[model samples]
Target chain A: MALDQSFVGRTYPPSRPYEVGREKIREFAEAIGDDNPAYRDAEAAKALGHPDVIAPPTFVFSVSYQEAESVVRDPKLGLDYARVVHRDQQFAYHRPVRAGDVLSVTSTIESIKSLAGNEVLDIRGEVQDAEGQPVVTVHTKLVARAVEAGGTGGAGEAAEGE
Target chain B: MTAQIAYADVEEGTQLPLRTFPVDRARLVRYAGASGDFNPIHWNERFAKEVGLPDVIAHGMFTMAEAARVITDWTGDPGALLEYGVRFTKPVVVPDDGKGAVIEVAAKVAKKLDDQARTVQVDLTVTSAGSKVLGMSRAVVALG
Candidate 1:
């Protein structure tokens, strides 16, 4: 099923503020095998001018993706979760997320289109501190591959994105 | 401190050191737990194949995190990064073999986006098994 184009520009409500925790940042860094001191030690982060331990740049994706689930789960939008694959991801940060900062996300559907028989959706997320200060802007692109009639739907060699 | 690279020392075409990140099933499970992205395609080979993927695949964000290491290790500060973007053109298929897979990264300062703030845009060439995994991979960093 094709997505509803009118849903483009729909902005979801701000999510509950999430605390940026040092332990979570450390866990994320260690999971990726990154030993950057700034990600683990408060003093190391402070030395770099951050008030508390800083998260790796990609850290916000975890939080934002969770929040974006609201859009994916929006029955009105009719997005089939299983058909979706990640296409592109981008982030612009005014500042790195610190250990103690509280953050919230507001997601907007940027665009909806069909390409190569796949439905492509773009969502832009605005992340702000508790004070409503911009922390980062995230853009995520997802593609929903067309399900063919003969069950060759997901099995095609076209190799859609992930 | 802020950025180990001297603002004056870096210019367009300054090459960053190459780095390699090893990926395996164990690491994916760990990342899935930490990142909360338990999309079975990343850990379950059977599920991945059922979804038309060749084998167990690493998360795109996982490969992205590995690519950024080349910059973070060089800057010596993880927070120095200002912007990062990439298109998932290819998946890094991680096999069940004990050796797993390796993502090789090479980067260079593609442009100096700012002169006063000491910011530069770095372009990356990331590959897995000699195949480009991320398209238009780029990052803007604060060298202040």
Candidate 2:
């Protein structure tokens, strides 16, 4: 089923603030094998002009993707979660994310299009601090493969009838 | 400071070395916990199957993070990055086995910035089962 075109350009409400903690930042850095001291040592981060231990660039994904649930999981959108492939991701950082900051994300459906029988979703997640300062903007593109019509269980067929 | 490759030393076709990193269920769970994602599709195979996924999958950010490692390691400093982006072209399906998945990433100097910093663009992809899990991915790093 094709997604609802009307859902395009829809904007979701701001998500609840997620507090950045030292432990979470530390864990994320360690999980990716990043031994950068700015991710774990507060003093070191301060010495480098950051208020606290700063998060890696991808850390915003934790907050942004959750905020995107308002769009991707919307029943009206008729999206097939199973067939969706992550297509692209880009981040524009205004400043480094710090441990003591509380952040919220507002997600919007930037575009919906069809290419070569596949559905593509472009979602923009704008993250801000508690005081409403922009921290980063996350743009994600996802492709949902079109379902094949009983063609002997081909490419997109595995995603159907879920 | 001494630099191996400087802004003036690189060109468009310069090929940086490739990197491979592991992605397992345990790491996915830890990512879910730390990031507060908690999406059932990343951790529960049953839920993933019920929702039309072949099996539990790794988070897109997980793949991107592994890709970013290649650039940061090459620069010798994480702070040397200015901007980065990628398209999650495929789902990294992690089958339930002790063996984890791997993401391979490579980079090059795509463009030069006006300042002393050069914009090093990276190309990255992840694969499993001889299938391309992610594609069309790129990252831009700032180097002195």
Candidate 3:
């Protein structure tokens, strides 16, 4: 099924504030095998001129993806989570995210299109600090393969162009 | 600590030094916990295979984070990076045989901009076993 074209440009409400923590930053850095001291050492972060321990660049995705639930779960949009393929992601950071900062995200549907029975939806997640300053903007493109598409009924079905 | 690599010191097509890192099941579990992705496909081989994955795969964000490390390590400050993005072209599948996967991250100076801030554009890639796992990875960093 094609996603609702009318849903384009629809902006969702801001999500509840997510408090950034030092432990989570450390864990994320370790998970990626990044041993940068700024991720775990307060003094190292301060020496680098950060107010607190700073999050790794991709940390904002946790909050942003949650905000995207607004669009993906919308009944009007008619999305099938089982058939979704994450196509692309981009981040434009106005400022680096640091620990102890509470942040919120607002998601908006930027565009929708249908190509070869696949529904492509572009969703934008804008991250802001407690003071309402923009921290980063996450642009995510997700493609849902139409159920009727041939050879898509089973698992392991790669999306087109894979 | 500001960037050691200044905008005036580099130009288009200058390749940054490469850094390779390993991605194992332990790391994937930590990533799932930290990022709250908690997807079974990233940790459970049985579940992953049932869902059609060739094997337990690393999260896309995990690979992006590795690429981010390459930039931050060079610049010496995470804040030095102003923008970064990537297209997840392939999955980093971690075979549970204790012989983890590796992502070789290499970067190049794609462009330079003129301004008081002195920003440089960096192009990055994450490859594993001759396959490009992440593509079109870019970063803009403020230089000293």
Candidate 4:
């Protein structure tokens, strides 16, 4: 089944505020093997004009994508999670996310399209600070593959085009 | 702190230094934990195979981060990164083998967007196993 076309332009409520922790930023940096001092040392970040340790540019994906769960899990959307694959991701930032800042996200369905038996859904996440100021806008595209004929759409079925 | 690269000195077609990042299973596990994305395909080989993936794969977000290093490392300022985007063209498959897989990232200054903002648009090519993994990868950054 294709995603509900009506869901397009629907905006979900803002998620609970998530505090950006220094340790979490450090852990994320380490996981990606990015030893940029600004990601670790407050002093280093301060030297770069940031108040504290700033997250790597991609760190916001953790928060923004999690917020997209509301859309992905929407029963009305009829998305088959098992057959879904990440298609594209883009982030436009107002500033680098800094440690100790609290952020919230409001996810909105940007578009829903069907192409070649695949459902392409785009969700835009608006991340804001405690002051209600925009921090970053994250755009994500997910493609749900169509189930094969006479097949149960069970596990081990690869999506076409890899 | 690494010295910030001045915007005035950068020219179109300037290539950023290349960097290679190794993606082993252990790193994927840590990334999953930190990102709160417990997608089994990124960690469990059985689940990945069940999903028709070759083996355990690195998270697409993880691959994006690794590729951004070229820009960040060049500017020496994370905050300088203003915009970034990528299309997941292929998976960075990580086998159980100790060597895992390596992502090679090469980037260049494709264009200069704004002189007043000192912003330059960067184009990136990210590859794994000699195959492109991220397509249309680009970044906009503020320079000194």
Per-model DockQ against the true two-chain complex: 0.68, 0.39, 0.59, 0.59
Task: For residues A1-162, write the lDDT of model 4, one tens digit per residue.
Answer: 667788999999999899999999999999889999999999999998888999999999888877897789888777987777788899999988999989999999999999888888999999999999999999999888777776444343342222
Model 1 chain B: weakest 10-residue lDDT segment is B1-10
- Give lDDT tens digits, candidate 3, residues A11-89: 9999999999888888878777778888899998988888788988888998899889667988777798877777788
Question: What is the CAPRI rating of model 3's predicted complex?
Answer: medium
Local accuracy by lDDT, each model: 0.88, 0.74, 0.83, 0.87
The runs of at least 3 residues in candidate 2 whose Cα sits more than 4 Å from the true structure, single-residue gaps closed, are A1-4, A80-83, A150-162, B1-11, B15-17, B37-57, B90-98, B113-117, B125-132
List model 1 lDDT by residue over A1-162, tens digit each: 778999999999999889988899999999999998898888888888888898988889998987777887798999887777888999998888889889999999999999877888999999999899999999998887777767655652323355
Interface RMSD for each of the candidates: 1.9, 5.0, 3.0, 3.4
* Residue pairs with backbone atoms closer than 3 Å in model 3 (clashes): none
lDDT of 2 by residue, B3-72 (tens): 2356666777677787778788988898777666677878999887766667888877777787777766
TM-score for chain B of all predictions: 0.96, 0.85, 0.94, 0.96
Q: What docking tier does model 1 reach?
A: medium
How high is the lDDT of residue B53 in model 1? 78
* lDDT by residue for model 4 (B29-132), tens: 99999889888888898877766667888888899999999899899988888999999988888999889999999999999889998889999999999999
Residues B105-132 of candidate 1: C-alpha lDDT, one tens digit per residue: 9999999988888899999999999899
Runs with alpha carbons beyond 4 Å of true place in candidate 4: A150-162, B1-3
RMSD, candidate 2, Å:
4.0
